[model samples]
Target: MKYNRLLCAGIAVSLLWVSPCPILSNEQNTSYASPAPAKGRAYYEERGDIVWEVPTHRKLIALTFDDGPDVSNTPAILDLLRKYDAKATFFVVGSRVEKLPHLVKREREEGHEIGNHTFLHSSFQHISRNKALSELDQGQASIVQATGAGTHLFRPPGGSYNDSLVKLAKEKGLKIILWSWHQDTLDWRKPGVHRIANKVLRNARNGDIVLMHDFVHHSTQTVEALKIILPELKKRGYSFVTVSELLSNREKPDGLIEVNK
Candidate 1:
């Protein structure tokens, strides 16, 4: 398997394009932290290690949708993803996942990633310590029970996170996944399809994590934007991947990280 490389890295990049709807890149992917990786809890105590982007030179991006597994919209979004042969990460709410276990399982079967978005979609950064931890615990349980896998990726609700939330997230063994401002589609606001598509492609770059919501009010606009966005990004030389695939610099697993199912 070929990996992606960063701009400053000395590794020779091998470009292999997988033909289909969206193209897949075989270039090596690596991260060069601005402040650098460190040891001890004090190290991850900062926000950088929480991982907002992959920091690679290869033209690869991860599409992450939050608060989903909805009966109506999730299937539509999944259809769009299938149409483009693209993979994405879904940060799902626990209760929603419980109510839509089949949808959650479908996401796993279809090769999309599932992440913990909290049981109640509460503000982990602002909630009380126990409450915040409880949210993560419950969310993890629901996901594992529903999909028979554990997610190491988590995204705070509404993107309202802080260093404290980082600590709690690490306690749960989850790596925080945030969105870059440049790639935020803002489809949650029901932005017009054209506007959402334009925003994502405007300043898109390598190692970007474009944020969209599958069930934010509804997913019609998001699904429509994807019809345009996926192929357009592919045309502009971008490959879609899951968050873990982007971070780990490898292909996504055949299924999720299954636990004792």
Candidate 2:
């Protein structure tokens, strides 16, 4: 994903100074007041860059999954989540949602939140404006048709996005969502389950949006990790919530979004 280099660097540096809860001074407060464009220009301009990721100080975490409605795998993940009595955000591809509208409905019916991952899971940056809009439109329509759900949130495939794209989405009344923490499971690479679990446990924190997968085989590892990670977080007094619930208070147009899970 193409990311804004300056934005990426800024986040890394910012993360270094930000701990659990260091109340910002009055001057520091003014600087971070505005909500950023969730996905930056680079996300839509470059096909391989992730535009933006959220950073916060609250003790809440957003768990998200992407690229699926893969019948076999997605249901299992949902089942596991149900067992834990947890809810999360699923960024569903437009085409995939069409193929498995029932699954999409289940996601919403089950009390899980759904967001647009675009139609066909393609790069919003590389495609033409017309095609990009079509992808977004199709996905949005499919999700609504399938679940009677209104999704104003979008997560670009591969997290690639650009300025024009953000504007387009916003004009359509959608908010771009991205993640702050990555478990780095690379589940598609078939990493071990235990290892993936450990990575999340070690890196997760309050207000973290953890990225994991549902389509890949090794994603089972992510499920396994969640088993341990969720309990541990609970022990530490951290609560799990959908990306929107954690990022935004009762008021505010911005919220944390889970992506590329």
Candidate 3:
């Protein structure tokens, strides 16, 4: 997934700090999965990645939002999660953490997981291992400084990861998490709410991880889609969990363990 990195950086540099809130509220409306192989499932074939989806039968799935802590879209997304009683993992950027520290703390207090998404949201392909480590170090520092919590989860910006990046993250006591290819809502494209909803609901399965964002305005549509997805999936007997908790329940052994339970 090639990210609009230049665009993201521009937005970061130009925006001044604002209080976090839902997009539908005033204050300048703004913004902001999965595995399982059923027939016609969107099976992603990424080579050399660490963790994508947990291969399990626990009826658990993880919803992960990336490039966030945005003042515009984050709070509303948080509200929706609480409303649904759904827990998610937020992969937040470092500078965004500095801009909206309260939101990070709020996410922690609300029982959501926060992971390092890099200092400037640099793509893993563009950064060397050392640079990647530095990104996590500084990103985690900001998160800890703001929320009084530290994260062991590291997700490379733009879903671009490599062996060296994964190795360094593990050495730093971090886990590299990517999303289930079948469940990528591509909400960043602002594809309509129904499209996003259909894409996820039609394809998702147990032990999957979903990728989404909290930085675009149309992300409110992502929120709207979640309104439909949450109840529909709950009706289907699916349970929402954080990325770490999903991995914690993985059938474990050594590195990259397979399910055997």
Q: Give Cα distance to truth, residue 99, candidate 2, Å.
A: 1.9
TM-score of each: 0.76, 0.71, 0.76
What value of lDDT does candidate 1 attain over all alpha carbons?
Answer: 0.77
Residue 44's C-alpha lDDT in candidate 3? 26
Candidate 2, 112-203: lDDT as tens digits:
89999888877654456667778889989989888986797788766555556666777777777767535555665667876777767787
Candidate 3 residues lying further than 4 Å off, grouped into runs, are: 1-49, 128-130, 217-219, 252-261
Q: Which model is ahead, 2 or 3, in terms of TM-score?
A: 3
Please give the distance, in angstroms, between residue 233's alpha carbon in candidate 1 and its true position after superposition. Answer: 1.3
Model 3 per-residue lDDT tens digits across residues 165-205: 55577688887777888999999899999999898899988
What is the lDDT ranking, best to worst? 3, 1, 2
Give the runs in model 1 whose Cα sits over 4 Å from its true position.
Answer: 1-48, 250-261
Query: What is candidate 1's lDDT per residue for 121-233, written digit by digit as tens?
Result: 87543356667777888999998998899898888776665455666667778887878768888888997999998998887988789999899674489888888999999
Better candidate by lDDT, 1 or 2: 1
Query: RMSD in Å for candidate 2, one decimal?
Result: 15.2
TM-score of 3: 0.76
